[model samples]
Target chain A: MIGELELILCDIGNTTFHFLIDDVEQKYFLNERLPDFNETIYYISVNDNATANLKHSNDDLVDLEQYVNFKTKYKGMGLDRKIACIGYDDAIIVDAGSAITVDIMKKAKHKGGFILPGLKSIKDLYPKISHKLQFDFNTKVNLDKIPLCTQDAISYAILQSIIEPIKKIRKKQQIIFTGGDGEFLSKYFENSIYKKDLIFENMKRIINANNCIA
Target chain B: MIGELELILCDIGNTTFHFLIDDVEQKYFLNERLPDFNETIYYISVNDNATANLKHSNDDLVDLEQYVNFKTKYKGMGLDRKIACIGYDDAIIVDAGSAITVDIMKKAKHKGGFILPGLKSIKDLYPKISHKLQFDFNTKVNLDKIPLCTQDAISYAILQSIIEPIKKIRKKQQIIFTGGDGEFLSKYFENSIYKKDLIFENMKRIINANNCIA
Candidate 1:
């Protein structure tokens, strides 16, 4: 007779740490709050400095570069990206979080990728120049051509900043969008599927495959 | 018989005010250091407040939206943009200054336009997030795909930001690029021509046509 499997998976990001255990998911800030979990923690981190401060079995951490099944020429692929690519075998995976990553995975192989500032990050960055330049995500602006007003102009610019790269990469391939702004930006893409907790889903696969065992 | 034509043409922009008179060109700060020129300035402005401060005869300043020969539905179109599109009768006029304006004109008609932050402005905006994000204009980067390093990624993003819009607007039309960063961005664009002082050139035509007399 076998007992129930017990495991704790954590994706240590730059801002927040996402945790999944026994199909229950929770998130905490990397700096402000720390959860009370006692299980064997299997983790993948984008921020090494913050991850180092945490207490975990060193061997249980997932090496994203080695955890993947496919081969990649990019030596500096981040942990978040490597996990996002897992199971998304043959599609363009776009992570629109703090940073927008447009990584092309054609036939289970990483062709290439791009990283640009996210919608929030760009909106935040632009305010330093002119406080009037604001991105209203709720404001529906047409992308068929240039927008007229400042708000719409900014909204369109931010949208194009993300979409243009995907268009450059999308050659009739399915696009899988994930991240904070994925829900908002995905609607604009014709052939895109928005999936939340993608990193957590990838983490589950990685943990189940015993890839997190260092 | 025509007399020796003399005029002071001013381009009131977001940041600086560019002035030209009888082949003598000068610029003044939009806020801090005003120019010492006392000539009756024939001007077009994006900054109405700044233009209001400057002393000009009632008919000296040109109404951009009304002065242009072509018709446009965009009510808030800046004067600099209207002037840039003057001589570019049948082409895409891209002005990459404080703001990158891509206005498509076909057969002497305004099709539509896009507005994005300029390269310098984008570079300036990025540093607020991470001081490490330094934009070295001298560094040449590959825009075929997303770059690897942070600096290269940013460089590629900024370059892509400009190039991608032009690609979308381009439909076998002659591309005319002019601005502070126009010379730099023009190299990446194929079959494109870079022309400096395009606004000034357009201003000459506009003033001679008595568009400012309105």
Candidate 2:
């Protein structure tokens, strides 16, 4: 809890607007109008439209991108991904949202990362290839064995494909899973931590560091 | 060579009509008219439109789906995948065309398989998710390390995701890489055989067994 900071934090993505106020979390769709709030909202957004909407509203807004001073060699990295890595010094950060962004943080600096189509994106893609390929992923799929059926096969390919590279790259570091699908994906890994409010927590850290309680 | 058999084998996919005549391979786009061949062509197709087109053509065609006697518990398996596993008694058959189908053939019996979107499908998907993800894959990406750039990261995820599962399932069995992308994906694996004519060779085996050289 960010005691006495009295900060209302917002993390906006392509689809949803996530807000945390007075230690209470709330979510709103991007299309919906911004909620009327009395407190100033400090926010980071990857969506330009959302940022624009928030700026035009009568609410007090502080764009937090200016407050982040993280170091990384990766270019064109998403703002949400950058903020998520703020407090992690040595961890593999897997943000599984509309897109899964896997980044490596070492010695409190960004070591770079990769992006994969999220579970929903992958699910939507299969049927576009062929109707025969259309099947829901078996979420409880056994990744250790090669699947013999179509459903399990698709599930294995989707899950194992994402899991293997993370396993390969992880060496003596705890994997931190965040974002929407993070909980579902974290089940397959060992020595991993799932923190849904990772971004918000880091957002609070940034606020504390900058002392931007104005 | 299908010596003395004098057979013309065709493999029809969604995009191309692949023909092997007198051991000479030729390819024609699906939109183009079928070649005016004199010899009777034996073929297996996963594309309904192509199958219908060939049926309406003047060319002599034999559908080999009736001749296959393979055993598997998998339902709704594509005819193309079934035929590709014809002669491989113990191998991981990877047909890397528009869709990469990985099947295990054990003792000349089907043990079922899984499917992944081909490289092109994967390449096309990234951009649809985000404009930042629109970069072309680094074909020569080093999969051993976590990539520090966007291009290598996407490439590693795409390539390693596919490779690791195939390696995991393969135990003392040869990995047979076929289809359009077969030769390219084969470079990452050791003790893997790239058989461009795998489906055609298997088709010939079916022809020999059935003695349908009428």
Please tell me which predicted candidate would have the highest DockQ against the true structure: 2
Q: Which stretches of candidate 1 lie over 4 Å from their true place?
A: A1-6, A56-71, A125-139, A145-151, A211-214, B1-7, B56-70, B124-139, B145-151, B211-214
Candidate 2 per-residue lDDT over residues B32-107, each given as its tens digit:
8875677798999989887888766645888898998878898778888888887778989999987899999888
Candidate 2: TM-score? 0.92
Work out the TM-score per prediction.
Answer: 0.83, 0.92
Chain B TM-score for candidate 2 = 0.92
Q: Tens digit of lDDT per residue, candidate 2, span A71-154?
A: 778877888889888878899999998778999998887888877778788888888887778787788877766677888888
- Taking the tens digit of each residue's C-alpha lDDT, what string does model 1 give over A1-214? 0115666777887777777776687777867546556556777787777687555324344444455565687656776787888876678888887778778887777876766666776776556554444446534778886665656666777678767867876788888889988888889778889999788777677656764443
The iRMS of the candidates, in order, is 2.6, 1.6
Fraction of reference contacts reproduced per prediction? 0.32, 0.73
lDDT of each: 0.71, 0.84
Chain B TM-score of all predictions, in order?
Answer: 0.83, 0.92
Error of 2 at B70 (Å): 1.1
Q: State how far residue B124 of model 2 sits from its true place (Å).
A: 0.8
Clash pairs (backbone) in predicted model 2: none
